[model samples]
Structure formats: C-alpha cells, structure tokens
Target: MITYQLSKPVEHGGHTYQNLSFRAPETGDLIAAEQFKGQISQTVAMLAMMSDVPLPAFKRVPLRELYQIMELTKDFLGNALATTGD
Candidate 1:
C-alpha cells in the first residue's frame, strides 16, 4: 500500500482523515471506475476505490493535494502496464 499524507486534511461523515492509503488497484476497480465518463473522474474514482474511501470525501481535498494524488495513481498504473508487457 502507498500511504499519502494530505497537506490539508479532509473531513467527512463527522470524521477527519489525515492520510489516504492506496492498495494497488485491481481489474475490478478499473471496471467500477468506468461508470465515470471522463479520464479525470475515472482516475479519482479508482483512487477512492483503492483507498477504501468514500467518493464524496474527495470534495474536501485541497486542489494541490488532488493533483498529487492523481500523480500517484498514474504512477501505479504506469508501473503496472510496464510490467504486464513483459
């Protein structure tokens, strides 16, 4: 799991979260996130699924932090693709 410390914490459902830990996304996560139409939305959905976090909670994340989170997700996908070709 990759744990990311949020620069700005997120509050949701009466609780605050300081960090998000993402497990490597499985094929099910990719299928699930496909309900979202755009690439960005899909990526965010995948992140939520991998982190076991509710999607609504992502609304409170700071913009800068969101970009970093996207980058992390991209890195995971990139690494997975790189290995699968071999």
Candidate 2:
C-alpha cells in the first residue's frame, strides 16, 4: 500500500470532491517504492486517458517524472472531486 496526500482542493464545475489517500506497509523513498508508485502511476494514467485532461507527451519518462506528474494529476483530480462534493 502506498500513501498519497492531496496538495490542493479538488473542484469541478463549481463543486468539490475528495480523492483516496492511504498508507503503505513498505518503507522507502518514493523512488524506492517502485511497486506502490507503479500502481498509482498506472491509475493516474488511466484516469487521464479517460478524462478531458491531456496525457503527458513522454510515455517512457523516468519514474521520478511520472511520480511528479501523478502527484499533480492527483491534486487536480482531488480538487475536482472536492468541488463536485464527492
């Protein structure tokens, strides 16, 4: 299990929303948490594909870059959710 924290409020179309946050059992830096990060990264990518948001340009970027983009996406989605009152 991986833990994620929302850095911004999620809001969409004048509504608020919330996103998932959990603590993982493994202990390591984000870079070292490959499995956990991979799961989150995949989830983010899927969501981006299904949403209005444009996907990232590079598909083979490093995990660190993916992690950063995922965090931003998570925050954006969280804010959208918050705004939608989800």
Candidate 3:
C-alpha cells in the first residue's frame, strides 16, 4: 500500500480530515471503474474502492486537492485518471 499525507487537513461541513492511502488495483476495482460512465463518479468511486477512505470522504475534499491527489496517483495501479474537466 502507498500512503499520502494531505498538505493540509480538509474540512467539510463541521468535520476535518487528513491523509489518504490506497493500494494497487485488483481485478475487482478495474471492473467497478468500467461499470461507471460518469467521469467524476467513476473517479471518486475508483479512489474510494481502492483506498481505505469511504466515498463520503472523497466528496468532502476540495476540488483542487482531489485533482492533485488523482494526478499524483494517476499511474498507480488502482488510481486511474477519470477526469472530465481541466
């Protein structure tokens, strides 16, 4: 597993969180990514499924941070680039 520490903690509503970790993709993760067509949903789901994080956690992340994390892990086994916008 590869672990990444967020530059700063993220705040959503009244909660704050830090750090994210994910492992290399397995066959199941790939299959799930294939099943989702929406770019954002698919990306977040892929990340959540591959990582220790839950889906709600990704939803709480700021867009810039989310993009950075996804880009940083783009070539990672479980983290595919599924962006629809720049």
Candidate 4:
C-alpha cells in the first residue's frame, strides 16, 4: 500500500479526505479503467480504483496534487509491469 498526504483536505460526498491510500491494482481495475475513452479519463479511473475512492472525489483534489497522484500511480504501475515481464 502507498499513502500520500494531501496538500489540502478535500470534502466530497459528506466526507473530508486528508490523505489517499492506494493498493496495487487488480485485473478488474485495469479492465474498468480501459472502458474510459481518453487517457485522462482512464488515468483518473485507475487512480480512483487504486485508492478505493469514488471518481467524483478526485475532482475535489487540487490540480497540482492530482498531477502528483498521477505520477505516483504511473510509477507504481510501471514498476509492477516491469517485474511481471521476468
């Protein structure tokens, strides 16, 4: 698991989030993310799945933070992919 503190808290769906914790993505998460039409939408869905957060909640994140989250997700997934090739 990976945990990241938010630069600022975000309120969504009656909950306030101070941080995001993500588990490694599963096969279902990957398939679900692919359903999105664009790379941005796919990445957002993937992040939501990995973090176990609802899609709408990500919209509340600051853009700068969101980019960081995207990089985090990408790096973790990339590392996973690299290992699986062995």
The candidate that achieves the highest lDDT relative to the unseen native structure: 1
Off by over 4 Å in 1: 79-86
Select the stronger candidate by lDDT from 1 and 4: 1
Question: How far is 83's C-alpha from truth in model 1 (Å)?
Answer: 17
Indicate the TM-score of model 4: 0.82
| lDDT tens digits, residue span 1-86, model 3 | 66667777766556566878878777677677667667777777778787756667767777887788777777784334433323
Of models 2 and 3, which has the larger TM-score? 3
Task: State each model's C-alpha RMSD to the native.
Answer: 4.7, 14.4, 4.3, 4.7
Instruction: Specify the poorest-scoring 10-residue window by lDDT in model 4.
Output: 77-86
Candidates sorted by TM-score, best first: 4, 1, 3, 2
What is candidate 4's lDDT per residue for 35-67, written digit by digit as tens? 777666777787888988888987778888888
User: Which sequence of candidate numbers ranks them by lDDT, best first?
Assistant: 1, 4, 3, 2
TM-score of each: 0.82, 0.28, 0.68, 0.82
Error of 2 at 6 (Å): 22
Error of 3 at 63 (Å): 0.5
Clashes of 2: 19
Candidate 3 lDDT score relative to the true structure: 0.69
Instruction: State, as a TM-score between 0 and 1, how close model 3 is to the true structure.
Output: 0.68
Question: What does candidate 1's lDDT look like per residue over 1-86, in tens digits?
Answer: 88899987888998788999999899898778777777667777878888888899976678788888878777676643332211
Residue-pair clash count for candidate 1: 0
- The list of candidate 3 runs beyond 4 A from truth reads 7-16, 77-86
Worst 10 residues of 2 by lDDT: 24-33
